[model samples]
Target: MTAADWHARAAAITPRTELFIDGGFQPAASGERFDTVDPATGRVIAAVARGDAEDVDRAVRAARRAFERGDWSLAAPAERKRVLLAVADGIRSHADELALLDSIDGGKLITATRQVDVPGSAAILQWYAEATDKLYGQVAPVASPDLAIITREPLGVVGAVVPWNYPLETAIWKIAPALAAGNSVVLKPAEESPLSALRLAEIASAAGLPDGVLNVVTGFGVEAGAALGLHPDVDVIAFTGSTAVGSRFLEYASRGSIRPVWLECGGKSANLVFDDADDLDAVADAVIGGIFGCAGQVCSANSRLLVQRGILDGLTERVLERAAALTVGDPLDEATRMGPLVSARQRDRVAAHIASGRDEAELLLGGDALPGDGFFLAPTVFGSVPDDARIMREEIFGPVLAIAAFDTEEEAVARANASEYGLAASVFTSSIRRAQRVAPALRAGTVSVNTVDALDVTTPFGGVKQSGFGRDLSLHALDNYTALKTTWFAGA
Candidate 1:
């Protein structure tokens, strides 16, 4: 489609003004609400339900009822697959509308939201839908004729706290697998982005998802999010956010042993460049893409760069030039390369990290906030950075890349492994030997050699260390949300 046509179509997508709870769309029960503002213009885009602890309880109760009395859990696997497949088809039908909502709600480029996130979401849902019927219990051989065994059950209600970045995609990531595994959900969408989740309910209902099976309560982390995390009825709490908050949620859930938890958290991934690398300029751009894509909002963003001392200066110069060339403006504008952060608070946090870099490392380029109404931070880079600097250690969660020099593979491996966050890392050397050599030493859940973060919909995307635990986006994703059972039968 033409760019003009795409934008025009994106403009027509509906902007939902209410929250979906228990098969109904309504204003806040507390008579309170929050305004969603455009980070670019700082204008109130819309007012949405301001869910609280009470609302969380209400949602959880509904989910509990659905799981208990509802046919969802006890239904045949084929029946469950039918409903989930319908939900998946519903998502595909509303892809344009959902993408548009995401673009407006969180200020992501409409192209990305449309082409990548939305389609990716549909694929994820559909994949899980098919897997529902395929989920099986293993048969165990038993020697005794008197023994009989069987296994299979749902965890009941699940409380999912979705992050602002890739709101709809993240929600679908956990929700699809959970529901396919026969669990009802209470989705606590981030305050900054909740419109699409509301719309998802509509699509699901239209697709024939039963009442009370899936509910959403949009609110801040302190109220709805925390409540959902600690709710006694919630059998599982799947969260995607910071490491610190993940720890707190883990602690809260572990207190009673009532429910288990899964978290996908922070990262300071290392992207190493070798002197023998074939594509230095291309490598520079890939590095930038890995770090600055989605305005550097990703948890597994390649924020740490370790270039061999031989090519450090060259790579640094080229990367800085391209990063400076990035056009930071309205997400709706097709010409814009970088968009605003999720909120003003996010912008401020990124700014603080940039400022702190002055004391810990040499400022390379793009640190100061630009003169604009939007939450725009010029794509930033820091040089002469130690492997142990605060900028490298903390998840800045912005378009800030830190560059450090290393002389050998051992040094590069050491530097990359120094950070507590081992989410993802990349190597840019041309030699297969070099890639094979270094891939083992880098401490991360996933490593992409000769590329940045190229995620397959089928691969298990997750992290190790302080970056949080649990996998998403693959067969392994199902493993975390679903339980396994072994069936034993006695043969005479």
Candidate 2:
């Protein structure tokens, strides 16, 4: 469809405005509402239900009831698998509507939401669904007449708090595995992008999910998210966001029943290009996609670029050329490669980082916002950034890149691993020896060789250190939602 076609469709969309609790749509108990705006045009899309502690209590109580009543939490594995697969099918059928919701509510590029985000979410659900019945239990090799069975069981009443960056996709990342494990869930989507999540709850309900099995509470983090974290009955809390907020969940867990908390937090990842790299052009392309894709809002974005001094000048020019050629405009336009930041507040945060870059490093590219109703910013690049420069150390979560040069392999590895975060890193080089050598040396949860942030459902995704622990994708992610239980039988 053309740009005009997309805009017209967006205009015609009547966003769902209520919270999803107990498998039905409802308003906050306080009767309060908050405006959700389209960052693309800075226009109010709809007034969403503003859930607080009272609403969270209702959702959690519903989830607890569903779990204890065996409505979903005690269902057969094959039955759960069927429902999850059907939910995946539901998502696929409403691809365009889901894509449009994210674009208008969160300023995600419509093309990305349609192609990558929506499809990726469905694929994740299907992957977990397929694995649901395949999980196995272990029988202990005990002496005659005595037997021990060790099995993985679901943790009940999971509270999932997801960020707004990849709203639907991230929500599915947390819920699919939780649901597949036969656990009831209460999902708290970021207030900035609650539309798609609310829609998803409806889709799941239509797909045969039991009422109260998958509830969604929409509101500010301080209210809804905090309540979910602190609730005594929640068996687990799975969160993805900033380090500061992740720490808050830790504290909340400590104060309560001390339930398992899985956190996937912030990152300031580094990308290294050695002098022996075979393809400078390919490396430059990866660099652009690494930091500029999603307007650099990704938690695992490679915002810090480390280049060997020999090829520093050459690669920097190539990256700058690509940055200059990028088109920044309306998110609904298929041709637009980058969209606006999620909000005016985020734009200002990024702008503050750029301002610090100007004072601490040599500006090689853009550092200004585009003139439009949207919250767009020109991609910015800084060179010769000091090791201590705030831009190099902090996550400037915008289209900003910090370039630093190193003299040797050891220096590159050292500089890359210098950050407190160990979420992800990348190494672009042609030599097998260097690739093997440097990838292992990098202190990141996932390292990409000759690429950037390369990950799939087949592999685990997460980080170490301040980036937080616990895995997100792959079969290992199921570990977060399950616990090992050993049942013993003795014959007298």
lDDT to native, each model: 0.85, 0.94
lDDT of 2 by residue, 1-492 (tens): 888999999888888888899989999999999999899899999999999999999999999999999968888899999999999999999999999999989889999999999999999999999999999999999886999999998999999999999999999999999999999999999999999999999999999999999999999999999999999999999999999999999999999897999999999999989888898999999999999999999999999999999999999999999999999989899999999999999999999999999999999999999998989999999999999999999877889999999999999899888889999999988889889998988889999998999989999999998999978999999999999999999967
Instruction: Give the 10-residue window scoring lowest on summed lDDT in candidate 2.
Output: 10-19
Q: What is the lDDT of candidate 2?
A: 0.94
Cα lDDT tens digits, model 1, 1-492, are 555676587556657766677788877779888998767668777888898888888888888888887688778889888988888888888888898788778988887998899988988888988988886665455566645454556788888888888989999998988888888889988899888999998888778787888999988898888888877778888889999889989888877556678888999998988899998889988987998899999998999999999998899999999998998887877788889998899999999999899899999888888787888888999999876688988899999999989998888898899888989999988899999989988889899988898687688888899988778887677666666565555456
**Model 1 residue 90 lDDT score:** 86
Misplaced by over 4 Å in model 1 are: 1-14, 144-152, 486-492
Number of the top candidate by TM-score?
A: 2
